[model samples]
Target: MKSNKRIILHYDMDAFYASVEIRDRPNLRGKPVIVGTSVITTCNYEARKYGLHSAMSVAKARGLCPNGIYLKVDKEKYSRVSKQIKNLVLRLTNKVEFIALDEGFVEITDIIKSYLSYEVFAEKFKRGIFKNTGLTCSIGIGYNKLSAKLASDAKKPGGVTFIKDIGEFADFISDKGVKLIPGIGKKTQEILGLKNIVQVSDVLKISLQELRSILGYNRGEMIYEYCRGIDNRKVSSESKTHSISNERTYLSPLEDKEFIWSEFLNLLVKTHKRLKIQKFHTKTLTLKVRYLDRKIITKSKSMNITTQNIETLKKLMLELFEEIDLEKKIKLLGINLGNLSENKEYQLSFKNIENIKKERKIQELKEKINNFRKNIV
Candidate 1:
């Protein structure tokens, strides 16, 4: 069958940041190591015993594991190691989609043919990563991305899992929590929980139309397919850029609307600059706010016409930003310019001439400032 022909592999680095730290500092191997300044980005398995996990507050994590080694994030070091692992993956197959620095999907249907079995290939690939980087990875081999991702997460710190049959995949997730499904975040989980749809099996009880009515159209349709072990997402090596975004997590949560707006504007300017540099016009502007309680809310506005104009984007951004509740202290603010299309040459209307001149002047000023800073450095 078509399902039997496809092979997808999800590769996840085990406790990536913490593992990297432990590898560099042998003394931290068995001890609980927590990485992050304000929020816990990740922790070693030893720390998990104390109910410590990603996104937990560092202060709370300290209370959980008082003697645990706390370390600040070293993004540059982790990124360098991630590149090394990527290079190793590229040597095996170029059909790879790296969703994050530590996790990615690879379509290995063609490459797996050279191996005696899928298990053998997974072990060999795991060994290659460990040999080169001194870090272990878990790999999930399956017929689709969803199954493969779940499989990879099933085992950790150097383990391989394979879910080849659709029936097997369905059985595996049947008793799992609905939150276990990708894209079903806390908000969706709460909504589902209201309807007593807590488990994967509970989702199966509802009809597609019922789910759509509950979650609107798109998300409901997606959940319907995912719960049935029917994901058709391709593992593309050269995926098109869908959005350009910038986000900042404050060391301390801010309550002042004016200060938050100023920070929000900075993110908008940075994101807009990237959009212009990439020569893409965006139709949708999204604002994401993360409250101190770790709950996140997003509001989005889609324009009738696509634009790269900073003024137009700024207006849209303000509209979305205003939708956020300022009564709650917020820890993070993010802006996303999406529904992107390549900027193509077109005859400008008289109305656009002044805006174009203003943008050019701004770009020139930025270039001059950057050059001056470089010279001084």
Candidate 2:
């Protein structure tokens, strides 16, 4: 069956941070573990079994698993280990792409053919990865990125699995939730429930238009193609994010205009810090908000010059936010920077030095805001 499923592999480290924490402290071996930058990082399988996950707050984590140990991320050490791991992976194939410090995708179909002893090859590769990085990863071998990712996840944490033939495809994925299909999120799943389609196999029977009308264009197309285990995206090679932005999901719904402005300021500051490090800029800042009942609204305007200053952008964000009447509390708020362009020095106008200085002040405030938010939640 000439399916679009490419010969791809999804590689993810098992409880990456927790494993690293355990590796460093042998004493932590038998205990449930948590390792993350904030409260949102890696939690051990034991904690996961208790319904705690990557993004859940630490306070919430403790409630679910009182015995779980928590530790802050040691990024410097992780980076050092990741570099060593990358070297070992390069031994397997030249087409390896590292998506983050711990996760990667390697295209190894040709290498698999060359090895002949694939299980031996897998074992050696696994050993090499572990010996070098002190991290255990799950490897999924499949016909395409999607299937391969799913396969890798079948057996986790120092586990490897293969998708040999398509006949067993249904069996492999039959018990999986529709949410695992990538495109079907919580909102979409509810929509699907209304329509009586709830499984990977169930998607095969829905008309494309029916899927499209319900999920919208890109997500619908993604479902239609992915159900057959087809994903054409390459190993997701590293690229500069096209735009930089930040958002806040209010701790609780908020309607206070002043409080909302303060939140926007904080976000702008954080986003500016990231933009500074990446050496990128955008031509526009977009302000977005959602109401308690799930009503979303957005506004955007282009800047005359490229900048990522928090103070400058906050003025714009507040201007946009203020335009919306706030009789009700806001459930979610976000900011987006778009119309990206590489950095270039603009010709400063002498006719408007005060205006230029004021503009520069906005940029400076953005820088300050970014710095201030670094240690904040």
Candidate 3:
């Protein structure tokens, strides 16, 4: 419905990791495939037909879809493709917030249903992706980010979901599970289960005070409002980089140099992808380690050049992670990129005046480079 507030769009890459896998291996297009390491990242809709989905136990997933194929995650490839997708979206709106590796919220202040009609956005985005690197995305449009996300998720596989009026909110969420709201984890769901809170109406039936008593004040208030489809958070356009990082707590703590090397590679690749997509370069790379006792250690290194190159990042990460003793149970590891600069502006300033002129010219060139991904990823 019409509102004076911001028009937020939630865009999600449908089964992103799986979609990318299918893009690379065309033969897997209609097949069921799961991408993950120790857990299932997500299974294709085809796999879903056999009762497969993200976070499903691997053994159960295998039992559910005996014919499905499983692929180990390729962080480098996924990160590269994800960057391409982000580049496409950034071209649409300067104000965006990434909520996950594969999902984001775009605030359309200057443009809305007119410039970015749900239909046009979907077709253009899907086309752009297909033409550029052969991938797809699903988009949701609403007056708010949360609603838009629900809209996008209502459909599957390169579809557009949108709501035109706030009056539709009740009907929209009527059938949704209470767990659909953010912050309602499995544990919360179990508690709600005891209260017979399986649906939105179930939450709506409870008073704010009672809900607050169970879910804590802040979270309870959010749930009450969300159940009634009310949100006031703004979609900010000036979301400059404050921090960018990639982290993983191990399935098991091990000191094998080879294993650490591999994990470091994974974290760096993911972090670098985030850096490139944001169009920001960083001079300081921080390495983080969490010991078994939860003691944290961090190391920082400065680079003469800011980059997103995988090989360079991998080498840097290796050197940084190597400083830690493997004998200690390192349960968690991460790579952080800070000391930010706009990759373009930083490069130009480091060079001469002529290069500054060249840099201005290259802004268009960079836009051209991402033009293909600008539509689809």
Candidate maximizing lDDT:
1
Q: Which runs in model 3 stand beyond 4 Å of their true positions? A: 1-3, 57-60, 113-122, 238-377
Q: Write the per-residue lDDT of candidate 2 for residues 1-377, one digit (tens) a residue.
A: 24443567778888877787788888987788887534658887777887888888888888888877878878778787777777778777778778787777888767666676546666777777787766688887777677777887888877888875565566787666688887677998998888778887788788788788978878888898887666677865555577777776665899888888778777777777877777777678888888888899888888767765667777777678768768888978788888766666555467556777888999999999998899584
Compute the lDDT for candidate 1.
0.91
Mind giving the per-residue lDDT tens digits that candidate 1 earns over 143-163? Answer: 999999999989776789999
| Candidate 1 residue runs with Cα over 4 Å from true position | 1-4, 252-377
Q: How many steric clashes does model 1 contain?
A: 0
RMSD of 1: 8.9
The best candidate by TM-score is 1
What is the C-alpha local distance difference test score of each model?
Answer: 0.91, 0.76, 0.79
- Give the poorly placed runs of model 2, Cα more than 4 Å off: 1-6, 36-40, 72-94, 206-210, 213-218, 238-240, 246-270, 286-299, 308-336, 343-377
Each model's Cα RMSD: 8.9, 9.3, 13.9
Candidate 3: RMSD to truth? 13.9
Pairwise TM-score winner, candidates 1 and 3: 1
Q: Compared to the true structure, candidate 2 yields what TM-score? A: 0.71
lDDT of 2 at 250: 62
- For candidate 1, the TM-score is 0.74
Clashes of each: 0, 6, 7
